[model samples]
Target: MTIPPCTESGSSVLDELKAALGSRVSTDGELLQNRAHDRSHHDWAPPLAVVEAASTADVSAALRICHEHHTPVVPRGSGTGLEGGANTTADSICLDVSAMNRVLTVAADDLYATVEAGVMKSALNAALPEHHLQFAAGPGVDATVGGMAATSASGTTAVHYGTMKENVLALTVVLADGSVITTGSTTKKTSAGYDLTHLFVGSEGTLGVITEATLTLHPIPASTKMGVWSCPSLQHAVELVVKALRSSLRLTRVELLDRVTVDALARYTGYTAPVTETLMVEFVGDRTEVESQYARFAGLAAQFEAAEHASTSDPAESSRLWQARHDALPAALALVPGSAPLPTDVCVPISRLPACILATQKDIAASGLVAPIVGHVGDGNFHVAILLPPGDERAREQAEELNARLVERALAAGGTCTGEHGVGLGKVSAMAMEHATALQTMRTIKASLDPRGILNPGKVLAAS
Candidate 1:
């Protein structure tokens, strides 16, 4: 999808966009400033204009204008993505679909739900109970479905249900050329010619703009169980959680929080941190089965000489207990005022989690930086929320030391630098190291899809 070359008339291009989108388009300072960057907290960059798209047609129409103008477009959702995936380049435009929030369709029988790109996770979860169906997993799904699919995000539940790449059934995309394409179906399974469904899953809007999505959903768990396991150290907790995941119990989610992170959550959310480094485990099944699983799981944690085992079957109690797990990101971020959370993720084989986590802690100590570690430990993935002093160059410099070590340690432990977060701007350099020859293949794909390089200029692959 070659956008119109910049060599052409720029005024005509802006007019075309205005004619197509009318009131949906705006050059408002506030909206442009807001859309200029994502949750990345990078220096704000106001785009030339902002297009608050309302429908697929609106997106298509706006893209056509951007194409004609050869203007770069930053695809934005809730602006909740930590990475700078949605930062518009100077002179570019921001395509915000926040108004596209809608639950398009729900196939309860087939266990599927279709939603627009701008629908919030809480909104979808709210509507799921009517049919006893909900989206199973996404990248910490507090953001819109489109953003999650764009990044191919995964969270704790991804250990069991998989990530957006695994669950995204189909997408309605507006390409760089202003063409609309549907790549996959919402069916349970398919063996089609080209699996474009997976292609755009994590393209981060460089390849195309995702306007809508059809997603696979799962049944609401009949019964839910929660438990907190406290261990002497991070290594002990990781060891036991790894073992618990490998065992017979079907754990829906297992999140680990080191002592510092636990304390941060305690201070922010008013939830008491378990006395020791802890792993929060959740299981879902039939009422009786859930009880049996909880009992057996608690026994396993106890075997590790876990300092304590707190289990709850009550829904309200379970929500409160697990809120810390689900809300760890926002809650922990709140602990450090004015400073944005600089989170680095590393994913290694399950067996290496303890060593990787311990090494990370050591690196943090060496750097003399305080980092709160938390993440879905079920898949050997963990996040160290490095709270840097706002606008303090010295703190950021030190944080980079720990960040680089975090990557090195994960690679040394046979894990990836990132489990769910896409390599927007922050991880591109690391990705070059991780993918090696494979990185070239990704670049080729990007070039083939976006030869003119107008979609997103500096993301994933820099312009050649």
Candidate 2:
């Protein structure tokens, strides 16, 4: 659908929106330019205006105005998405909810918390420490709650605590028509009419704008231990991790970093470790149980000829190690200064992970791209940050082609095109191949809920 260029009628609609929203509406050129793109490699024309919604009522009003004016609306949070999910078009209104950052209620007794859409994951975790609880599922970065919910995000802790789809109990959403509705309840289990809460969890704001969320929290683990193992090769590292998963030991976090990624982390974060294929493992539980699990894992690693590179029980040291792992992308970018990162992720069955990653490594080597591999291999997911020179269209095409091949390999291996990152604008093409006939059902649902296609146009589904 071609979004019409803003005309005099659009100006009048903007004036009406300003009248209704007052100082909340902004036409600042600098801000508009900054909001035109996200952390992704994709860039678009600047949005016509930005509406910073501070409350559910503000979201309702903004959506109501945009719906009536036939204007496109792109819902956004912290703009930390790596898939261009929050990027806006030239004729659209960017509905930013970052200012709606507030924790409304914390039910420590019930192990749940109700927070506004814009609450940052780090901030929420910080607030939960006093209650001996935490919001377990996070996407590594300090992403907004609403954004995480919108993308069904999961990170290091997902292996144990589950993803957003499992943790979110309810959502307060504003529909495209400006109607407000609450889905699900705080109850643990309910034979409700429909699971609308999950339907919108990974909808990418194509159906409605998430305003608030009721999330389940977990008690902070009493004992946490982090360790890194260095393997002779990537194959050995992946094989050992798979073996550990099948064993009796329970691990909270299992991350794999290729040699290139390890080198990047060493230079960028000043972390000292053996420069080889590495597996970062963590165990959390009762002190005795944690230590038992660690010892069992050590034995398993030894069988694969892996050496213990580092181990720490101190909270500060463990945090530093994990932070370096999370900084893999930036570290990769630092390796090749003045280059853009085209990061992509894919997931396969645990048994096929070694083969998939090994083949991908070969492809990367042949393509001569500075793409480093890092992943939450415990769940069969990994990411490749393909770095390219700025404005190098030829190199970008080569990288995209390589990405397509990678997705094809995963799909053939009974895996998904994306593991954590939602299909914003980057992975839309893979939807049909990944979902097959189910793509039509998705389109039907999108049409039913957002008939006008005003919410986050050109995202997730094509021709939305």
Candidate 3:
């Protein structure tokens, strides 16, 4: 689907967009170039213009106009996505919802909050602290609520709280043709029509644009504990985590950082993390519950030959440790100067995580690539940061081939190609292989919702 090049007559569409949206519609060269690509390694492709949508009406109107003119529209929020979901195409209009950053309502009693699509998860959490509530499904980065819902993201906390798909109770979505629909409801359950809210949650903007979301919130845990345990090997670390995951303990966060990642984080952050395969686990609950769970976790690790198990209740210390985990990607990148990082995520069954990760580590060593592994081992999801030179085609190809083989191995082990990172431009080929005939069903849905393929062209589904 090609958007016609701008002619004297084609300029009318731009005029209408500007006239309808005032200064919100911008064709500024610098802004266009800046918003071209996301954190993904997808090559830049600037949009014809960007519309800073401030309201659901603005989103509807913009989409209505774009729909009428057959202009591709790429919905963007915060631009923190590691995938190329928000990256614009050559003839597209970037619909940025960052200006719609408002928390519409917070029903503390109902344990839900309604927020505009552009509300960042960190901002919402800050606001909810007073109420002892938190929106827990965050994707590490300060991503927008709408974007999180779009990509179905989950992070360290997801093992306990759940993913965006589970946390999001409802959504205010603008369809491709500018029709507004409220999916789900303030009530917990509904025996209504299809689960449209979920359909759009992980659709990656190919179906519609989410303008607002009503999300389920959790009460801030009464007591929380953080601990790091060093294991003899990656397999030992993963096996210990799998035991905890299967237990009745309510673990809030369980992460694994390989020896390379641990070394990198220690060097970059000046924090003295154990220089070995490590498992970082956090438990949240009542005082007694947290203490008991932490004890059980330690006991389980002891069976697997745990080297060290140190637990802490200090919030400040816990934050410092988790911050190191968050900084792993950047720290690893710093390890290989002047190299572009290609981050890939895969999830396998808990029982296969050890084999999958071990095989990947060996594969990386044989390929001679400087890649470090980090993971939320509680959920069997892990990420590899492969460093490739900026313009080194051979290095990029090697990284790509490694990524493919890793995904294949994970798939054979009954896992997914991508765990949280949505299938943007980077994982299209993997999606084809992973989904097989089911990929056609996705294409059909994409066509049904966006017949012209004007919504996020060249995303999720491969170009047919």
Candidate 4:
């Protein structure tokens, strides 16, 4: 994956790109090299060049130049991503889209928002209070809309509002040949040709480069309530989540945190866990409906051998509880100094989630790994972050073993290796094992759309 000074096209192509982009393009020194890889602990291999795109035009023009030069272009967002989707190799340029963060249009009437792909999710949520409308795609506040769409991200709201695959209405994409195409419609659902919008949603920037997006919005809930229920163990928490999902109550968000994770977070952050495990649930609606929903959920809680149930309607208090959940990654990372996480997202059927959790917990203990677990239990998607210190070869190997066992359990339960996080370089090997048939088809699509394989080469599908 190392480029030999781009001999295929030579210096003229590089000079052409540098001339057109000027200061926007750069060759790797040290800073550019740092931004090339994502949050993964994977080995760093910086791109040959980096481009800080300011607009859709910049992206399209860069793609055109790369297409002609037979060079690869790697699209990047905020680089907050845990997966290795943004990692770069040789003869490629990192298309950094962070500088293009602009909210182009906010149609309150249409209930849709159009923004440059660099727009952050937290900024969108912050700007929505005036209209009482909010964007639903929340995949850790640090993620960008473009990154979320590329990975088909989903989080606490997924059980109700659905994933980015459902939230994104359209995308302005620059194809491999620099031909631009718009997918999906502004008016919601459609019976369109090939559903290309979805095709690229979780394609992880292999099929095309996403420059801008139109996203769906929902009315902010009139009254929102969050609660914490403590359980005996991670298994008990998963059981409670399953029961809560099966109940008549419409839960907005349901998340599970294992004993190991709670203990780690307690040691890292100041917050203490009420028990060995806990479930954070949210109920949203009008004043009367929200209270009624809580009552109904409480009734179901009693049946699940509930150890403790705590509720808070105050926005400040709810935010405090959520702040801890939202900061789970950073807090867990705090426990391990000078180390990166080997985070694995595994989702299973509701009936199988408890089993998967139990198996994962046992596997984690058996593998001699330090894995703290947290997940969106509402839709049976969860993550186990394996902490590996720098130069700890044994820990890395043990973490890898646990990862394999976790995915095996999920797959045996008829689930995927990854639920929200896309198959970037970290999950690429597991994806091959889990999706042998679909993997070839995905490669076929990549080959067909990007004939020269100049768009994000060696990602999602390794070079054939």
Clashes of each: 3, 0, 0, 0
Q: What's the best-to-worst order under TM-score? A: 2, 3, 4, 1
Question: In model 1, which runs have C-alpha deviations exceeding 4 angstroms?
Answer: 1-11, 326-337
| 1-464: candidate 3 lDDT, tens digit per residue | 33335655347778899989999998888888777778888865777888999999999999999999888899999888877899987678899998899999999999999999999998899899889998888788889999999999999888888899999999999999999999999888999999999999998888999999999998998888999888899888887877777787778898999999989987888758668899889998889989999999889988999865466888888887788788998899888888888899999988999999999999999998999999988898999999996688988999999999999999999999999998988889889989997988888888899998889888899877
Colliding residue pairs in candidate 4: none
- Would you list the C-alpha lDDT of every candidate in the order shown? 0.80, 0.91, 0.88, 0.82
TM-score of 1: 0.94
Query: 1 or 4, which is superior by TM-score?
Result: 4
Candidates 1 and 2, the one with greater lDDT: 2
TM-score of each: 0.94, 0.97, 0.97, 0.95
Which segments of candidate 2 are over 4 A away from where they belong?
1-6
Clash pairs, model 2 backbone: none
RMSD of 2: 2.1
Question: Top lDDT: which candidate number?
Answer: 2
Compose the digit string of candidate 2's lDDT tens values, residues 1-464: 23345688679778978999999998888888877778998867778888999999999999998888889999999988889999998889999999999999999999999999999998898899999998989788889999999999998888878889999999999999999999999999999699999999999999999999999999999999999899998889888988888896688999999999989988988878888989999999989999999999999998999999889999999997788787888899998889989989998998899899999999999988889999888889999999998888888998999999999999999999998998999999998789877988999999888888899989999883
Clash count in backbone of candidate 4: 0
* Pairs of colliding residues, candidate 3: none
